[model samples]
Target chain A: MKRNAAAFGAGALFAVGLALSGMTRPAKVVGFLDLAGDWDASLAFVMMGAIAVHFVAYRVVLRRPAPLFDVRFHLPTRKDIDLRLVLGAALFGVGWGLGGYCPGPGLVSAAAGSLGAIVFVVGLTAGMLIEQAVARALPRRE
Target chain B: MHDFTPIPALIGGAIIGLAASLLLLTHGKVAGISGLYGSLLRQGTSDRAFRLWFIAGLAAMGMLVRLTWPAAFASAWSASLPVTLLAGLIVGFGTQLGNGCTSGHGVCGLSRLSVRSLVATLTFMGTGFATVFVVRHLLGGAR
Candidate 1:
């Protein structure tokens, strides 16, 4: 129960940050990506801020033997860079550039009652289901 | 162009990082939204309660912000129906295959100082720039 509560609070705070930082706005996201045109470099600041805080926090928290709630820190273990990784990232980039909505913003905007966001999220769900199916066929990774 | 909000961007981003830190210190989990959502759909994903509660919280916050600060979502992007759907599909499929998105790779993965995350980030950013170039410059549509 405590863990669940923590998760909830974290998600809520994350949404607040995303919205406040203008990440919820697709136009701002694309504008940052638009290098040729009058580029808005605000997204860089977002990243810089996020990374700066996280870099220190991650190290400090990791120094503890374990987390407060869990016995072990559950983290992704795979380290190899393969075709799947590169191809998948490149494909994701195309979609992000075209729509300017990654998973977080897409879900948030959809819940915020944007019609276009709803459409995009529906497509995103379908795509995820499709990827799940494909992943099953390929060698599954942890 | 929207006014450059460096202050809000930096502060909001710090909040995001703080949230991630809290989750990590408390639960020992990386706060990757894509990974959280994607794993929920799997057949036997353990730790189901956390994922559900987290996503529910995200949606709840969104609804709350809608009532309070509508302008945050004011500039919702809308393209042709087909294009919008296709873009969503690609993003979904790609993130799942890649095993992370901005939050996962950009925020958490990068924080760990992982080389894999770095490469993935550059790859996606590169293609993002290229795709935007094609759409805005070549195709004459990016608005």
Candidate 2:
């Protein structure tokens, strides 16, 4: 119950931040992506601010042996930069450039009942589902 | 950039960072939206309750903002229906395959000093730049 409450609060705060930063708007997102033409660099500030805060906050919070509500910190262990990561990122970037929405903003905007957001989210879900299917169908290489 | 608004951007970013930090501190989990949402769809996964609550919070907040302050939430991007749909599909697939997006890899993973996240971020940014150039300048997709 406490963990769930924390997650909910965090999500709400995140949504508020995304909207306040103008990230929920597809045009604002694309404006930042538009390098050649008239570019809007506001979102860069958003990234910088977020990184700065998290950079310090993470180190501080991590000093504790365990999370306030959990047994241990659940963090990613992967370090290698593989083909899949690069290709997947490249593909995601193309989509981002094309659509002006990533997962976070996409979800937020979709929640607001924007037609564009809804369409993009549907495609996003379909894409994810398809990827999962493909991954399963492919032979595993351990 | 003439449209640069640093104050709001910084504040908003800080809020996002704070939220991510809170989640980490309390739940010991990275606030990766794509991962959270994807896991909910996958079978045999635990922690469905937290995911549902988190997503619900996001939606409720969004709806609240839309209703309370419409002006502050307006956007300017306008693309064709087909273009938007295709872009959506690509974004969904790419993020899933990549295992993260802006929030996951860009914010949370990068904060952890993950090399994988760094490489992923660079690649996505590069491709995004290239795609925008092609779509807007070359193909005249939209202005």
Candidate 3:
């Protein structure tokens, strides 16, 4: 119960940061992508700042042997380049270039009651559900 | 390009970094948006109560921000609804196929120095650059 509260608190903080950073706005994203036009390099700075912090913090965390909340770091161990990954990357790029909203920003923007963001989130969630169903239906290879 | 300045951008970046770091510290989970959403889809029941709440809190923050300061929320980008929806569907499919989103892999995963995430991030980013080039120069349709 307490952990849940903490998670919500952390998420709220993240959302607030997204809002303040103008990440929720599609225009900023589009501008960032637009190299010829009046591009906004602000997001780059954001990325840099985030990377710098994570660089230091991750080392500290990894040294602890295990995380505070669990037993291990819980990172993915897969290392394969397949068709699904390539196709997915292409699709994601198309969506981002066209809509200017990725999952994180889309969720944050949806709170603004924008019809576009709402539609995006709904579709995003629906797609996930559909994928799960399809994955379940597939015959087990093992 | 007109009004939003550097101060807000810097402050916002710091805040996001702090929030991400804190989440990592407390929950020991990367603040990857796609993975969180994906988890919600699979796994019927477990220790997911907090994950759902975190998603909800994100929505509420949007509402609060808009209500408190509408001007800061102004955006310049505009596109047809159909286009945006199609784009979103593609992103959804991509996230599933790739096993994560930009936030999941690009930001958090790369930060952790995961080799897979590095490859995925490179692919996505390279694709993004190529997309913009194609859309603006070769195709000359999207805007």
Q: For each candidate, what is the lDDT?
A: 0.87, 0.86, 0.73
For all predictions in the order shown, the interface RMSD in Å is 1.2, 1.1, 2.2
Task: Compose the digit string of candidate 1's lDDT tens values, residues B1-143.
Answer: 45678999999899889988988998899988878888898889998998888888888899999999999887744566677799899988998888888888999999999877888899899999998899989989844
2 or 3, greater by TM-score:
2
Please tell me which model should have the higher lDDT, number 2 or number 3.
Answer: 2
Task: Give the per-residue lDDT digits (tens) of candidate 3, residues A117-141.
Answer: 8888877877777767776888535
Q: What is the TM-score (0 to 1) of candidate 2?
A: 0.97
lDDT of 2: 0.86
Pairwise lDDT winner, candidates 1 and 2: 1
Which stretch of 10 consecutive residues in model 1 chain A shows the poorest summed lDDT? A133-142
DockQ scores for all predicted structures: 0.78, 0.82, 0.60
Between 1 and 3, whose DockQ is larger? 1
What is the two-chain DockQ of model 3?
Answer: 0.60
Give one digit per residue, the lDDT tens place, for model 3 in B90-113.
788788877877777766777888
Q: Estimate each model's TM-score.
A: 0.96, 0.97, 0.89
What TM-score number comes out for model 1?
0.96
